[model samples]
Target: MEHPILFISLILEKLGLPIPHGLIGETFLEKMCQPYMTYTWFVMIFLVVVGKLTLSNIEMIPGKGQNFWEMLIGGMYDFFEENMGRELAEKLFPMIATFGLYIAVANLIGLIPGFMSPTASINTTVALTIIVWVTHHIIGIRAHGLGYIKHFLGPIPVLIPLMLFIEIISNIARLASLSIRLFGNIMAKETLLTILFILAGAYFAPLPIMVLGVLVSLVQAMVFVLLTVVYFGQANEHAH
Candidate 1:
């Protein structure tokens, strides 16, 4: 099959709904694949919808669903508060939390037999990287004003141009680094599982790898969030 997770389309088709036209037609890997409607794209949207419903359906008084949602949000609030400080973290909490949960769910779900991690796709990852990158810069500018540009310059006047040039490249490089890191890790994990399934055809042997994948998934998501936090912190910092 052209698509890595062909069964996703198959199952959706058998549900009596029309098969997604794009899936029925061409492979995502094919030339001129539209970015808007890939399997991973749908999966990402499905997750966001579920999360929105979960939050929307929550009650004021505690119950199973409310408690679960509260704990998740509460814990994340504390986590970011500790990392980025109460003020900055609270300010950026929504963006950080959303990014973290989406990525974490996307990675973990890919462990299932028929799901593919959207982060495994360069397009998905690059888009995320761009979002994070733009967010920090916008926050930085709003927080610190034009003085933010001074951070790119070195302490010494003579080195200002060189430092500014290097800093520009370094900041831009973050987009590539963020995209490649997430994509490489997820793609490697999926590729390894595929190879093991083909070679041994045993259910048990891949269990260890799957367990490791879970840890790696969480770590990758955490790393992505933490780096964003770091950027946010740096962005708001006053130039010395």
Candidate 2:
């Protein structure tokens, strides 16, 4: 099947820039500028620019921009607090917010004519899963010290072997679940939208699906954040 053309790469080529494929031909720049990676960098830069603009001027009365950001940050903080408790929310608000914004933007960008969602790439999702996996384990170790091992070992001494094996498998499964879930959903969404637009042969025909895509994008991002919060909460808990 023919894939949708990544307009970002096309633009770079037109601008006489070094791109991954046609212009650069098998070079290091080509390796670095994979479609997903290029869009990922765009998302990061977009977030950084928006954040800088939002924080550049603090107003007591709060303008429209300020109010929107305040509502977004405050609402997200409340949601995290509700799910993970105030203390954990306070500790993790920044990381969770960053993940939510990045994922949400990355997902939505693909719906635009020129861009593709980075999360559609398994490599990108795997990287995100790895970060969450390592972070929660670190949180567990820091919270419980060496006793974190007891989390994997059941209370009964006789069950340690079975419990440890089960826990190891479960944790590995978590990694796969997180990565594959995001990657599959996004890949499917992008592929379906692309095919729908092509089959319909008109831009307006896919309007309803595009609207649904926006909702799916936001819901997926929220689901990812919620699961992360749950994992952190579990890691923060005392051994049962």
Candidate 3:
């Protein structure tokens, strides 16, 4: 089946409108196709659509169509400034802000009629967590040289083996925690909303759930951003 929302989003994006790509339909032709399509093609498609939309409106000022983008950019900048200091924030802003915007937009997109939040998927969350985990270590090493590994070895030489093991486990847990937290919350919200729609099918019945979904989306976005900042901070600290 053709996704009308996706079609409309594509058209609007072409015309330089502010419509979000998440309004599009998300269905696989069969259950067997769901795993492959959802995990791989969906991310690729999302990147392409959002990339085109972003590039097309690059020259536009803050208008009705562009207000959301402007708000997101402004908010992330302000947040970075508050947490990371102006200099560091400016240096790291591009990477952090890009993650925040992409994730926030992706989460909010779920509230739209047809689209599913990719963040709700375990595959997406796990992949993102892995990337973040690797990024944290890479930055730490770059900043501190070989001494970055020393952080895990502890301040004392005798504790090196034990400390290293603990650090490694903790890092692995970070990935699991981040992925599970995001996936569980989003999936739960989606499931609850779906059940509500099934049970009541009344307009007002789903309103409250939808509102909650919006809040959850924002919270999830903030959590991801905050964790990113924390990870960066840890890396920078070791570097120093």
Best by lDDT: 2
TM-score of each: 0.81, 0.90, 0.71
Please report, as a residue range, the 10-residue window in candidate 1 with the lowest summed lDDT. 28-37
Every candidate's lDDT: 0.77, 0.87, 0.70
Writing each residue's lDDT as its tens digit, candidate 1 over 118-190 gives 7777777888889999988998899878888887896888998899999899988998898899999998887
Error of 1 at 118 (Å): 1.0
Best by TM-score: 2
Better of 1 and 3 by lDDT: 1
What lDDT is obtained when candidate 1 is compared to the true structure? 0.77
Q: What is the lDDT of candidate 3?
A: 0.70
Instruction: Give each prediction's root-mean-square deviation over alpha carbons.
Output: 4.0, 2.5, 7.6
Per-model tally of clashing residue pairs:
0, 1, 0
| Model 3 vs. true fold: TM | 0.71
Overall local distance difference test of candidate 2:
0.87
List ranges where model 3 is wrong by over 4 Å: 1-71, 85-88, 155-161
Worst 10 residues of 2 by lDDT: 16-25
For candidate 2, lDDT tens digit of each residue in 126-202?
Answer: 99999999999999999899999988997898999999999999999999999999889888888888888788847
Per-residue error (Å), model 2, residue 58? 1.3
